[model samples]
Target: MNIGFSAKTKAFYDLDEKAVYIQNASWSEDVKSISEVLWLNHCGQPPKGKIRGADEHGMPCWIDAPEPTEQERIAEAVNIRNAMLMTADTEIRQLKIIEEICALTSEETQRLMSWKKYLADVYRIEPGNVSSIRWPDVPV
Candidate 1:
């Protein structure tokens, strides 16, 4: 697709595709115009904690996303940990049900033990340190 930027609208467009490639959420396909488009360089993925934006010159650029506050980070970590714990709980319950129906093989026993250990690890995780967590592998 031929990418172009509109200085008037401060938005990017797919000139050949006749669509808004990126920019304001309010912009519509009907608002696009090939004549008003300024060609832009090929853009790749934005850097970590950054997003795609236009510079003062209306060129494609990377801009920083709003940084999460410490409280927000902690809350996010807690949510992640809770979700992980819930998944582990479901897995364990399913395995236990299978165990009740028939004797589990050694591999199944190891998986059950691994899930238990993973649950423990989830409980031990500190919300502040969740970004660096080394998650255990899920048993096959």
Candidate 2:
């Protein structure tokens, strides 16, 4: 829920053209839109796809509404990394529950293992090796 607010922006890519537009502010006074900002990016021309964007010096730069600073971009990446790690932690906790179930008696194992054979028997299909069960596709 991190929200960034910005009213001041410096265009990293496009610099040449804004000077001209601002010089003629009396003639044209339309505040720059995201598309316009990109169209006026650093190389002094609009991108090929207009909205899709351009690859400037091997960087996958896009037509952001307002491009963030390097620090902000790094923070965003860190947030995503932390979220993934939290998901991994939760999965590992659930896996311990399965591990506990695996430490069962031989009779329990046989009874549980036969459940698969019971399923295939109900389907009237021959159950092969317990370690490797390939489900047949279709009504057959």
Candidate 3:
């Protein structure tokens, strides 16, 4: 199931005070954006210090954590991209479903079905337009 918006408030660390706090939360359909922000907040190890605290600027600091490796950055990028692709896929699927159900003529239905089949076979991406997807025999 898709991650829908949550109405509850969210808690976060106050980097400057080194304290936990809560804020009013809002809904978002942008999964990538949410994930990226969350990664920024939680991915890294704590900065070098016995006590957790914010930087001079009162922003949360990650001074002690090691730099992110190339693989980590690449994985994060891929995850973000997938989230966006999933959102687009949902939209496309909805459109195709509506088109399929509302088609007034056999020709139109056939055309839509052909397009759906092409997407399924070639892209390994069905957009939920059909019952199943057929992956290519040869990998790209």
Which has the greatest lDDT?
1
Question: Alpha-carbon error at 46 in model 1, in Å?
Answer: 6.1
Candidates' TM-scores? 0.56, 0.29, 0.30
Comparing candidate 2 with candidate 3, which one achieves the higher TM-score?
3
**Candidate 1 vs 2: which has more TM-score:** 1
- For model 2, give the 10-residue run with minimal summed lDDT: 1-10
Residue 9 miss distance in model 1 (angstroms): 12
**Regions of model 1 farther than 4 Å from truth:** 1-48, 52-54, 57-60, 129-140
Q: Encode model 2's per-residue lDDT on 35-104: one tens digit a residue.
A: 4443434425446433333343322244544465666655665554455445444544444455487765
In candidate 1, position 97 carries an lDDT of 97
lDDT accuracy of residue 15 in candidate 2: 36
lDDT of each: 0.70, 0.41, 0.42
Q: Give the per-residue lDDT of model 3 (tens digit) for 53-88.
A: 344433333445446576675565555445545544
Off by over 4 Å in 2: 1-64, 103-140
Error of 1 at 94 (Å): 1.1
Candidate achieving the largest TM-score: 1
What would the TM-score be for candidate 2 when compared with the true structure?
Answer: 0.29
